[model samples]
Target: MSARRRSISFALFGAALGFATIATGPAKGFDFNIFVDPEDNYIDASAFLARGGFIPVPVIITEPAVDGGFGIIGQFVRTPEHPGDQPPRTMIGIAKTGNGSTAGGILRSGNMRDGSVRYKYGFGAADMTMPIFPFGLDQSVDYHNKNLAGFANMRMRLGESDFWTGPRLIYRQTDVSLGEDADLGPVASRVRDQINNLFDSKQYIALGASLHYDTRNNPLSPTDGINGVLRLDFYDDAFGSDADFRVGQGALASFTPFGEDWSLGILSKYKWTNGDNPFFTLPSVDLRGVQSGRYSGDAAYSTEVELRRQFTPRWAGVVFGGYGESFVSHTKLYDAEGDIWAYGAGVRYKLARKIGLDVGLDLAKGPEESIFYIQFGHAWGRDMD
Candidate 1:
């Protein structure tokens, strides 16, 4: 389906959940929240979950944002198969970021940490940046792109093995357009002359496999344990792709506790993409402080750390900082690099103690600007492990 159609589909799907539970009370296994003008100027009606357990959640938001608008989201977690069954855990969700991003997904896991399966369908704008010619010219063309994708994945725990391996397939269509403020005279002609297939929009497919491991007790807000992943995927003309390419991705996260109420957390990611791939698919830099994606080269790495101390029954304090580097090509990492750094601190409130969920906010400074995030969970993505 077209990217726009998929986005609308996910939005409608999430709304169905909202309609069913709107008149239902909290006793009916539903949780909802409303936040007005939270940073991005949107009235957010949401159903979110933390470590709090299985409950249906729905979220609606009115965003008075720049290049962003209204949206809805729905999410929940439950036991695999049925609520009465035991062991394996599962989560299903659909959401629209209001910045024109939308998606729906389901993930299942083995209680014994033996395996997992994930399926997703999505559409809308991708937070991507480019450093290549024609597409990356700051003075020439500010870029905007929308992507539609469907993905399926499965992983099995190797018998008595600590590692998990799985196969995955991805299909996507992307459309790139020039920003309104673009200037054509200065460098547009040169871009046109140098580029051959960078601007074309088309459908593509990728098939590959992944290996991962995680130990964090609660990856969302890890108080202890570790999380790591290694994955490689390939796409070629044989798969109806406009380009032929391969990508490798990896991440590692660890959390440790000290004393009674203190803990340390660290997260990191690295990516290497090459071949006839689209610019937006390249590795880029994103963390705190950096709002727009700016660095998309052949390789990139980013890392962040946080220190936390629970000071009260329902509150906690934290401080954090991180930096990133992007290389023009997939080198050994340290050799070809452009650095971007950011750091900040924030506080948290235990919104739902049963789930170990804390809702909070943060203000941080990046190399070029500063930003604030109304955090729902950890600012980064980590495996459930």
Candidate 2:
């Protein structure tokens, strides 16, 4: 072939390669959510209720400052809730002081998304030397430490919609402590410290790839419009495991109807662990059922589903229920083996674009007893993707 012909052929080959990569590369999906609370209204209400719920009397509290101080009661009150229409992306609240007075404040979050790559980083800390009244107890303590954390995630899409593929990466860390005057039992205090560190000092790194249909949308909403997500998570350092590994799978689907005024969603998640789960990386509510970390000889699993309905542009509701089970050869918390089933319902009101307010009540049944959970948001996928 002539030199000019050969150059043209080479150019064609390069174009084909580029096209193939674009068609086979992972599809880019992201969670880029943002929220701004103009005032402390929501947090204040949550705190008042948390305090009232714990104790028989109403405990009046003050607003926390925006410094390094914190107010536990106030923070708990200001914590945000999930609504069926949107995702849970951020939190804002006041810090507390040991004197039951306001000290500093806090802001925490991890949310972002752009084309084929998405990332999230969350971190916040506070030392509220404040007083606390444990429900049903008359004693109040004057010391507490706020915990902080952050994580990042990224993904690249694969092939066409007919057969999809991608990879994910994540990292997380946290710390917590009690006030000065209060004295906690050795076990309880240690437990508290451990819980605090779960999201504080510890770092959990994860890497995994997923495959799905081009037609299905990952379950970002409580309702599926004929699309869903089937994801598998593998860990290189599942909670500092490094060489130790664990895996988790999650399925989310949803549907909409009646001119988008109503919808329903379902989520089923299962996780299995091998190796002893790291000492500090078990699983807990703070991590929202996501696989955290573990060592050899340890294993755990969980499954859940949610239903939601939209009544109006500004009004909607959701119901979610699930079961969680776990086991370990030797862990102070899981030695006996246990399972928990939970069910709840909530309502939402959209106050702005992709921003809304939510209130919900959940009842959880376990091997030990029945517990109630009350808070905000629809609690499904949170801030629908």
Candidate 3:
């Protein structure tokens, strides 16, 4: 069987075992009502989860670039210590895709110093087969990669304001090669050699700083206010990197409520890279419809907008559209050939009322194909980054 199929089977088995254990285990005053919404008479897990429940979250991969797959994540959460505080979380997950891509990781996120400081850290490893179309080539080549990576970030609030700044660090080691079954087709021998040389195994370490501002009414389901970030990163031999480069990125999102039932969201982002860098580290046009890395270059920018209508207390609907462009240089962005557009619609169900968290599905149509995504919380959020 394919690795992804095996992963799904194992996830199913684990889910069944988890349910069995919960069914037979002790329940001191625990009742099924904890999983029900008292006001709407609908099924909900907000209360149970808030009370430090352990849940198994299913991972479904529908990215056309990855050929789709499934897996699972096991999560444990601790309730916040005070009102309006974020709950601390710990998670471990593993997944595989039809294209022989596999990944596994463990992550933790929480607040410290009484919410003055926020911290996140994670470690992960992946083996993937990725398609790349270089220099506006119409055809793509498959690149196989094995990587191990880790990152940490800590941000402290700026006194009493809604601003935060911090330092971040990332380390990764990767080995890359042309896929064994890749079809070179009409690609030239010189181009093939160049691609091979650009993908040699290397270790990379980067140090960065970030500035953030957030004034959202609710992070899980923001109906008002703005959130934004600016970041700069340096990767150099002094930091144990095999390549020296610098990257700068910025993003901003705003939410405005039109009434009790309507809300509008807009998000914009831009990224640029300078100095010698690996091909895999280049920026790409990140939009719902575009496959990851499908439109990458030295610089890229994208803007997306979403309109949401709350149909009922428990359900909402949304329509979104976006445009993006990738270019070799800032001066050539206007004339870039890698420009594209996409649009889609989706529905959401309020899964956790207290936390204002919603679960949903989206169907987007990009330049090449239509793809569906299973989403939790805001699709564009970076809270756990």
lDDT of 1 by residue, 1-385 (tens): 2221112211222243432332232323333333221333222232233232444444332221222233334344432332211223355655554444544545444433322333333333343212223334433234555566676666766665556677878888776654433455757656554443456577778898888676656534567887688878899889888789998888888889999999898888888887877655767665666544455567878888889898964567889998898777543322344667889998765443434445565777886566665554555543232
lDDT of 3: 0.75
Candidate of highest TM-score: 3
- TM for every model, in the order presented, reads 0.69, 0.46, 0.87
Tens-place lDDT digits, model 3, residues 329-362 = 6432223444599999988766677777777778
TM-score quality measure for candidate 2: 0.46
lDDT of 1 at 150: 71
Better of 1 and 2 by lDDT: 1
C-alpha root-mean-square deviation, each candidate: 8.3, 18.7, 5.7
lDDT of 2 by residue, 299-346 (tens): 445455655677754446666666655555544433423345556565
Pitting candidate 1 against candidate 3, the one with the higher lDDT is 3
Ranking by lDDT: 3, 1, 2
| CA lDDT of each prediction against the hidden true structure | 0.55, 0.36, 0.75
Residue 202 C-alpha lDDT in model 2: 43
User: Which 10-residue window in model 3 sums to the lowest lDDT?
Assistant: 1-10
Residue pairs that clash (backbone atoms under 3 angstroms), model 1? 45-59, 45-60, 46-58, 46-59, 47-57, 47-58, 51-355, 52-355
Instruction: List runs of model 1 lying over 4 Å from the truth.
Output: 1-70, 79-140, 180-198, 330-337, 382-385
How well does candidate 2 score on lDDT at residue 329? 52
